[model samples]
Target: MQEYQLALKDKRIAWGMAIAIEPLIGKYSGDSIRPGENAALDWNLPAGVYRAKEVVMELDKLLEAMLVQLGEPVNGDPAVLLDSLQANLAISGQHASLPLGPLALKDKAGAELTSQAVRIGEQLVIWAREINAEKRALTTYGAETLGALEFRSHCYGHPLIPEATRLVWGPLGGPRIMQLYNEYLHQFVLLRDALLPFANWEEVPFEIKEHTEFKGLRFLEPAREIFLTQLLGKKLTHKAIVQYAQSVVNSGLTKTGYGFQYRLGTVLPAGLGESAGTAARYLLKWHPVQTVQTEETRDLAAISFDYEYDDYYAAPRNEAGKGTTVNEDTLPVSREHYDGPSIARLLPNADSDRTTLRFSLEMEGREFTVDLGQLFRGHRFLYRPHGNDNAGDALTKRTSISSHRAIDILSHAGLVTNPDEIHFIPTNGNELVQWALLGKLYPENVVLLDKGDKEELEAAYVSGKGFGTQFLVL
Candidate 1:
C-alpha cells in the first residue's frame, strides 16, 4: 500500500508538471529574437532535443497510467501531441551547430524558434477555447448533477458517459471538479494575458477579457420560475414561456422591413378563452408612412422648352416638299406672361428635406404615435441614428439598457401605464437578467419572453395555428 501511494504521488507530480510545462514552453519558445541576437548559443541542440523527446514519452505514459488508475479511459490522442512536439523540435534543429559557423547557427535557430513558438501558441489557444467551452457546459449544468449522472451510468455498467466526464464527475469528482475548473481558469487567464505581446507582434486580434467567469448566477432558475409564475399564473408551463420567446426571435422581424415596431398589449388569462380577452395585434404588418417636409426652397436652374411650327404655319414650302425653316425673325412670338411665381425659380432643397416615421396605435381609448427611433436615441438605447431602421440591430442595442429603465422610458411615453400589461419582446440569454429584473418588479402583469417560449410558439405555428394559441400576441 505504501509503494502504491508513492507511485500515485509520482503520477500526480507528472500530471502537474505536464500542465505547467505547456505554458512555459509555449511562452519561452515564442520569445522574440532581435536581428543580431543569438538565442540558442547555450541550447546544446542534440542533448536538448533528446531530453524533450524523453520527457514527452514519459508524460504520455504517466498520463495514461494516471487515467487508468482513476478508472477513466484515456481520450487524448498521442499522435497529435507527438506531432506538435516533433514539429517544434524539428524547427529548433533546422540550424546545424559548427564551431566556425556559430553566428549562422544561432541566427537560424533563433528565427526557427520564433516560428515554432507561434505555432505552439496558436494550438494552445485553440485547446484553451475548447476547454473553456467544456467548463461552461459543466457550469451550466451544475457539477453535482453531472457527477450523479456519470456515477449512475458507471454503476449501470454502461459507457453512456464520456470517460473525461466520468473521471471529472464520477465517485471521486467532487473536489477534483472545482480543482480542475479553477486550475483551467487560472491557466487560461495566464495564457490569454501572456499572448498579448505575441498577438501585437503578429498583428492578430485577441480578446483580453476573461469571459469564463459565471454570468448565469445573475438570473438563476428560481428567479426565472418566480418571474414566470407571477406573470403567467399557475396555468402556463416553463415550456410555454420558452416557445413564446423562440417564436418572437424567429418572427422574421428583420426580413419584413418593419423597422422598430412595438405595442403595449394585453393577453387573456391562460384558460380564460381567447374570445374573452383582447388579442394582441400583429404590429409587423403596420407600415411606417414616410412623411417628408420641405423646410426650405432654393433656386435651382432656369427651365426652357423648344417648340416647332406645323407645315401650314410655316412661311412657305420649298421645292424639296419641306416647310421653310423659320428663323428668329420669321417666327411669330407671343408676349411673355409672368405668373405669380415661376415653378422653375424654386426647387426643394435636399438639405431641408425632413423625413419622419409616421405610425400611431390606439390603446385603451388613448391614441399615441410612438417615435421609437427618437425614444431609443433619447434613452441611449441605440447609439446609431439608423439602427432603428433594422429590427435586429434595434433589438440587440435595446439590451444595453436595463429593463427597469426601459419600462420607465415607455411609461414616460404613455406606452406603458401598467407594467403588468406590457409584454416585452424576446431577447437573447445575455440579456435575461435585464428582462428578468422587470419581470420581478411587476410580477403579475409583465410577461418576459424566453427562447423556450419561442420554440413552443413555432411548433404551434407548424401545426397551422397562426403564431400558436399558447403565445400572447405582441
Candidate 2:
C-alpha cells in the first residue's frame, strides 16, 4: 500500500503487544428450562436453547444451601460463585452452571441475602462507566469484576479510577485490588440484568451502580483459552478480553483515527447507548455455533464502530516545510494546557543541512502536534520513513514500530483505507497486512504503552529515554 505508506512518514518503528485468544462459552447450556421446572414437554419442544450446565446437577444440593454464603476467588482463584451463581440458576444444554434460585431482581430472601449477607464473598468488581450525558466526559471505562484490584465506598456508585480506565487484566499477585462493594454493584446489575434479553430489560432502567461490558460478538477466536475454567476463574477469553477493550476505544467517529479501536456491535456505534449521549454499557455475548465450539457463525449482529474518523478529521499534513530533530529529547505535545510552547520549541529544520529536511513528530500525544518534517516531501522518507520508536512513554512498551507506511498511518488514522484495518503488531513483525499502530492516534490521541523498542527509541534518539507481568489470565 505505497510501501506501507512510506513506513509511517519514514523513520520510527518498533511496536508490540499482540494478544490473540478466541473462544466463547465452549460448552454453554444455561437455564435448563425457563418454562417452569420439572416437565419441559417431556424433553420435547416449545423452546430449545439452554445451558446452566443442564441444571448443574439439579441445582447441586440446593447449591450448597445457596452458595454456602457466597465466597472465594478475589485472587484465590478456584472459580467462585459459578458466575454469581448463574443468575438464579436453571440450565440444560449439555453441562453445569445451574444455580437458578435467587436473583430474579429480588425475592428468595432478596436473592438469598444477596448471595449471603451482601457478598461478604469477594470478587464482583464492575466499574464499566461511560459518562457524557451532554459533555460530562468519561466515555469509556472497564472492570466489571475483571481482576478488579481495588474499589470501596459502601462498594460503588462512583469512584474507582484505576487512573481512569486502562486495566485490561491478565496477571496479578498477592494483595489483588478490589474494595468497592455496594451490594456488589447491585448484584452486578442484577446479574447483568437477568441475562438481558427481555426486550433488553425494558431498555434503560437505571439506578446507577449497575454495570457490565462484555463482547461476545465472536467474529471467531476463543474456544480454548481454557473452556469455562471452573466457571470463569481464568482460561480467559471475552474475545481476547474485549480485544483488550477494543484497544482502549478511540471511536471518535471516523477519520484516520481508530487508534485504540475495538468493535462490539449490538448497536451504539456512536449513538451512545443507555438512552443518552454516554451512559455507556456495551454488551454482545452470542453463543451458537450450535452453542460455541467455533467454525462458521457470522450473522455479525453485534458490532461497535464509533469515532468514525472526521473524514478530513486531520493528518494529511505536508503543508511542505522543514522539521528536523534526530531525537534530542523533545516529547511534549502540550502536556496539559497547550497551544504551542512545549513540542520542544519547534524548528522546521533549524537551518537545514540536507535533502529537503529531517523528521520527528516522534509519535506524540497529550493533545496534538505533528509536522514530523512534513512527511519528508518527495525524497520519500529516505530509508523507509527514517527509523523510529520507543517515544519515551506509550506505544505498547516499544518492541517493534518503525515507520514508512504503518498500514498507511493506521489506515489514515483509521479511515480504514482497507489493508484489513491493520491489527496485530507483535513488536514489529507485521502479519495481518502488518501490525504496529499503537493506541489513540487522535480522539485526543493515546500512546505511551508498555515501553522498550531498541532501548526506548534508542534512548530517545540518543538520550530521550523511556521505560511485569505474572498472570491473572483474561
Candidate 3:
C-alpha cells in the first residue's frame, strides 16, 4: 500500500491513470459516457484496476475521517470505504465522484467491511438530515428578517449550493466558499437598503440582529447608522406617515369642509420641512373651494295685524230709559280711536297696493328690520314680490337678494364691515374647496376651532389669527 501510494504521487503517473480511468469513472458517476466505451475496461486485471488506486485511496481517508468525527468507528478496509461512498452517493448526486466498483478492495478486504460501512452510512444519513434542517432554518430566517421586496429580489434562489453544503458538513476549502459568502453579504446589503426607507432599526429583534447563519455578515451596524442619519430628529417614519394618513381618513374629517384647512403643527418632525405639508395635502385629498354661487333664494317679509270694532259702541247712552236701557258692554266699541286701521277695511287691499313694505334679515339669532323706503332711497333695489299666504294681515315680500346687496344690508345693520370677506357654509363640494383654499392661503382669515396643540394655538393668536374665536385672526 505504501509503495503504491508513493508511485501514485508522481504527477505524470497520476495524470496518465486519471485519463485512462475516465470512462469507468463517468459510467459509475452518472456522467455522460459514450455507449460501449467501458466495455474494453477490465476491473479484474491489475493494470486496468491500478489506474483508480489513487482516487480510491483519497476517498477512503476522507470518508473515514468524516465518519470518525461523527462518532462512527471505522476499520482500515477498502471495501468499507467503497460501501460508505456508495451510500453517500445514493443520498446525494453531488457525491457521485466517489468510485462504485470493488476493484481496489476485492483482494484486500472481506464481507465484514460491509457491516462497518453501514454504521458509517447511518451517521452520514443523520448528518445530511441536520444539514437539510439548517438550510430550511436559514431560508426561513432570511424571509422573515429581510424586507418583502428585498427577499423576493435577492434571496429567492436555491437555499443551499453544493459547495455551501460541503462547507457545512466538512472543511471543504476553496474559492467557491468565499464566493458563496460574498453572495450572502450582498443580500444583506439589499436588506439594509430595503429597510432604510421605513424601518426603525432600534426596533429590530435580537434574533434578526444576531442571526446564527448571517451573524458574520456585520450588516446591522452600518444599516442602523445610515437609517438613523436619514431619519434624524424625524418624529414620523414613512410607515408612520402612511398610518397617520389612514387614521385621518378614518376619522371622517376628510369629508368635512375644513378638513384639509388645518395646520399639522408639530405632528411632523423637523427633518421634513414645509414641502411635507404639500405632500400631506394630497394624501389628505385637499381640494380648495373655487368660485361660490348662491343656490337658493330666501325672502324677507314684514307683516302687520289690524283690529276693528263697530261704531255702535260709541252711540250716546240713554240713561234710565226703558228703550232697552243701554248695556254699554253689549254694543261693539268704536275703532276710530284705535292706533291702527281696522282689519275689515285693510283685508281687501292687504295683498297688493296698500301693503306696507319692509326688509327683515336674521343672523346669528338676531333680527334686523329695515324700512323699504329708506333701503331703496340711495340704492337701486331690484326685487320681485313674493306671494303671501296668511289672511287678514298685510305682508310685503322681496326675494333673491344679490350677495353685494346682502353685504351692504349687513353693513348698514352693523353686522359686518368687510364686503370682500365671506363665510363658507361648506354644504357642497365647491364651497368646501373654497374653504380649503382660503385656509391654506389666508390661514389667519379662517377661524380654526381646534389647533390640536395649545402652544400652536397661542402662536397663531400671537401672529394675529384667531385660534379659537369665530372672528378672523386679522
Candidate 4:
C-alpha cells in the first residue's frame, strides 16, 4: 500500500493523470468561456495554449459525436473555420467575441427543459485551461520540485479524502452518516471554542449564526452559519451549553421558530438574520437553567396528576362506584345544541347586497358568525371591501392574498372562471398570511387586508389558529 501510495506521488505520472482533470480544477477560473470563445482564443493566449488547443480538439470531437447522435452531418471543420479568427487576434491584438450557437440542442418537456450543450462547453473550457496550466507548471519546474505541488493540488492521501473515497466506493454502507457526524463534530468544536467564555452562566441572550457549507455538498442557495451569540454582554451563563443545545435542537425542529419557509434536512441548523435574532431573544428570555428545570418538573407533575385523575375517574364505576361488568360504555355523551343558524346556512350569502353580509360566515363548532365588517370595523387602515375607494382602507392594496385559498374561495362563490389566474406575490408581507389563512368557508370575493394587521391577527396568522380563518374570506 505504501509503495502504491508512493508510486502515485511521481509528479510526471501524476501530472499526466492530473491533466485529464484540468477542467474540473479550472471550473471556477475567470478564463472559462463558451465553445465559440474557445476557438477564438486558441493561439497567442497564454502559457497554457497548447493544452487548451488539445481541449478544443476534444470539444470538436465531442460536438461531432453529438451531431452524429442527432443524425446531423458534421459539415464544417471547426479548426479550419477558427484559423482566420486566430490570425485576426495575433494581427489585430483585439478580437470580437464570437457567439457559437446551436452548441446546445435539447428536446423540451412540458414546462421544463434539459440541455447538455452549455455543460459540455463549460467542461471543455475548464479542462483546457487546467491541462494548459499543469503543462506550463511541469515544464517550468522540474519533476522533483513539482512533487509537493502535485500531492497538495490533487489532495492525495489526505485522511478525510480516503474516508470519503471509502464511503463513495467501498462496499460498506453509512459513509455519509459518518461524514455528517465528522462535519457536525468539527462544527461543535468550533462553536464550543466560540462559546467557551460564556459557558458557565445560567442564561445569556444567545443567537445562532448561520454558516454556508464551503466543503462537501453544496446548496443551490448558500447556507448560513449557525452559532449562539451572547446578546447580554460577553458574560458566560451556567446554562450556556444547554441553551445552545436547545437552540440547535429548536432550530433543527422548527427552523428556530422562523417556521418552515426554508427548512433543510441537514443536521447542521440554519436561520435568517433578523428573524433568527428575534427567535433567539425570545428563547433566551425563557431559557435559563431554572426555567428549563421548572418547565420540565411542571410538565412531569402535570402528566402524573392528569394520568392519576383520568384513571381514578375512568375506573369503571357502577351503583357503588366500584369496578363493574357494566362498563363505561353506558356513560352518556353530552351535546350542546345551538339554536342559531347552522354553519352551512351562515356561509357568506353569494348574492347578499350588504357589503358586510356578503363576507360574513358562521363556522361549524363556533358560536358566533365572523363578520368581516366588524373584524375590519374601525381598523379600516388594515382591511377593506374590495373595489371600494375608502382612503382609510387604502393600505389593503399593500397586503397580499394567498393565491391557493383565493382560488378555492372564488371557485366556491362562482366568481372565478379560471383558477390558475389567481397568483400570489411571494415578495409581499402577507405571504405568511396567504399560507396560514385556512378559511372555514369559501366565498365569491375576497376582502383586501392591509400589511399592518393587529397583534391578535398577526398571532393568528402565525399559528393558523383562532378567527384567522376569517382573514381569507370574502
TM-score of each: 0.17, 0.22, 0.17, 0.15
For candidate 3, report its TM-score: 0.17
The window of 10 residues in a row where model 1 has the poorest summed lDDT is 10-19
Between the candidate structures 3 and 4, which one is better when assessed by lDDT?
3
Tens digit per residue, CA lDDT, model 3, 1-474: 011100211110000001121333212322111122223210111111111122222122222332222231222222332333234433223442122223222211111122223333444334433333333322433322211111111232223345334542445323322333233323333223222221122121111112323322233344444433433333323323323322321222222111111111001111111121111221112111111111232211112211111121332222111111212222211112312111100011134323222333333344434332222210111111121233123221111111122212232321122222222111111211112222122122232222213443323222222122112111
RMSD of 2: 21.9
Best by TM-score: 2
Each model's lDDT comes to 0.23, 0.22, 0.23, 0.23
Evaluate residue 296 in candidate 4 and report its C-alpha lDDT on the 0 to 100 scale: 31
Prediction 3 global C-alpha lDDT:
0.23
Error of 2 at 397 (Å): 19
Candidate with the larger lDDT of 1 and 2: 1
Residue 280 displacement in candidate 3 (angstroms) = 4.7
lDDT of 1 by residue, 1-474 (tens): 011010111111000000111222212221111121132111000111111222222123222322222333323322332232233222133221111122232332233223434454445445433443334323443333333221001011111123344455667444433232322223222222222112121222111111122211111223334433433232433223322322221221221111211111111111111111121111111111111222342211111110111111232211111112222222121223311111100011123222123223222344333332222111211111111223332212111111222222222322222311112322222121221122122111222232324343222222211111111111
Supply the TM-score for candidate 2. 0.22
| Over 4 Å off, model 4 | 1-245, 248-297, 300-418, 421-448, 451-474
